[model samples]
Target: MKKYKGYLIDLDGTMYKGTERIEEAGHFVDYLVRNEIPYLFVTNNSSQTPKQVAKKLNEFQIQASEDRVFTTSQATANYIAQKKDQATVYMIGEEGLREAIQTSGHHLVDENPDFVVVGIDRDISYEKYAKACIAVRNGAAFISTNADIAIPTERGLLPGNGALTSVIAVSTNTAPVFIGKPEKIIVEQALEVLGVAKEDTLMVGDNYDTDIMAGMNCGIDTLLVHTGVTTKELLKQYNSQPTYTIDSLSDYLKHIN
Candidate 1:
């Protein structure tokens, strides 16, 4: 196996499932820290900030610092900033997404927005949908954090950002640029944050569709651990598999030298 200089890891499935913690996941992060290997918990979750994510990891007994966490929200803001400076945006999401946009020097407006961005908003309403649709129809740039149709939860499957992002897409018949997993945009931004070369970094996660595909799309190696989402059986259906696969993060511990 190739030695990866840095790692970009997934959060929800790979680290823990909702409020429950993953045992091997904690030790895996411990190994990274001990070896002085750089890694970032790259997440599609746009509801929480870096500090919030790190706190959650700490609760799980995983060692994490704020700088070691990166979210799709930050990627979205960075993307918007790169495209245009101080652009006016109409955003639909939680505190994390709002903070990212505003702190990036973008103006949050209700009318004639230069961009219309959507992330996961559990408290979604019809009015928010209408505004998003109106903004997109007004020739505003549309962006979605992730294309995940569903998110796995302790209760069962729940609607993800993509499902919520559909309203604007269907109404305006305009597709939003997705910045999360399975898209190269988020991975590129994560790599930039990690300060590592694509070839020398490994994308680590449990989901085959989003996490694995994101690495493949970004020309980076990926290691899929069966601690969450994709089971070994389901992974075989994919034509292109991840660079590496293991039953758990514990199985990968020996290879990290």
Candidate 2:
């Protein structure tokens, strides 16, 4: 097994399922803490801030902190900040996305903005879509946090941010730059935040399409745990495989050093 100095872990399914705790995940994290291996919990959910994410993890009995969480919202903000300083943004999302854009020193406006960013907004309205589409057509740069078509739930698969983002794209005939998993944009930025070389980081998650692919897209090693979205049987459908596959996070303890 390859040794890694840092780890990028997925939240939802990999760490816990909704409000429930994943027992093995706690132990795996504890091992990393004992050895001082750097790790960050990365998520595509742009509805919550890093501190909110950390609080949820704590409720699940997982060891995590605010700075140890990275959201696509942050990546989107960082991406925009890099492109132009003090750019004006027209947004379609909730608190997390709004906070990230503002904290990164960008302005949020309803019209004539430089960029239009779409994230998961549970209370989306036709008016919001109309304004975003109009702004994009009027020459605003378009960006989406992730292109995940669906979000998994106990109820079933529901539309994700990408699905929500398509309305504006189809209306304006423009594609938004996606900055989350399965894209190198977010991963590259995350490596800088984790302060670890890409070659020395390992991406760990339960989903093959997002987590594993994110690592592969960035030339980082990946470990796919079978506790989440991708099962052992389902994972074989992909051409590229994760560097390692384990049934649970506990199964990975032996290799942590």
Candidate 3:
């Protein structure tokens, strides 16, 4: 087993399922803390801010801090800022996505804008979708926080940001530039934040498609734990495999120092 200098972890299924926490996840984080290994929780959830996400983790008895969390909303804002400075944006999402765009010095407008940013908006309305479609049709660059179609919840799998993002994309016949997992954009940004080389960093999560593929897309090692969406049987269908697979996060503690 190779020692990793830094880690990019997933939040939902990897750490907890909806409102429930995975017990082994706390131990895994403890190992990282005790060894002084650098780590960041990378998530596709765009509804909550970093502080809120950390609070949720703390509730699970998992050690986490706001500074140690990176969200797709942050990635989307950073990506847009890099492309154009202080660009005008028309966004449809919750507080986290709104905060990221505002904090990045981007102007949020009602009508025509430079960009049409979409994330998970639980309060999604027909008017919100209409405005987003109008913005994109008017030539604004379309961007989505993530392409995840469904999210696991206590209720069951529900619509995610990707599902919400599709309204504008299908309406305007424009493909959105997705910024989260399975795309190299978020992982690349995360690596820069972690200040670690790709070869020395590990991406850990339970989902094979988003988490493992994100690492593979960015040339980083990946570990797949079977506590979430993808099962051992489901993973066997994929031709490409993660660098390591474990029954739980506790199984991975032995690989690290």
Best by lDDT: 3
Candidate 3 to truth, TM: 0.97
Give the alpha carbon lDDT tens digit for every residue of 64-170 in model 1. Answer: 99999999999999999999999999999999999889989999999889999999999999999999898899899999999889877777889999999998898
Model 2, TM vs. native: 0.97
Alpha-carbon shift of residue 142 in model 3 (angstroms): 0.2
- Residue 87 in model 1: lDDT: 97
Report lDDT (CA) for all predictions.
0.92, 0.92, 0.93
Off by over 4 Å in 2: none
Of 1 and 3, the candidate ranking higher by lDDT: 3
Taking the tens digit of each residue's C-alpha lDDT, what string does model 2 give over 84-156?
A: 9999999999999999999999999999999999999999999999999999999999999999999878898
lDDT of 2: 0.92
After superposing candidate 3 on the true structure, give the runs of residues whose Cα lies further than 4 Å from its correct spot. Answer: none
Q: After superposition, how far is residue 193 of candidate 3 from its true place, in Å?
A: 1.0
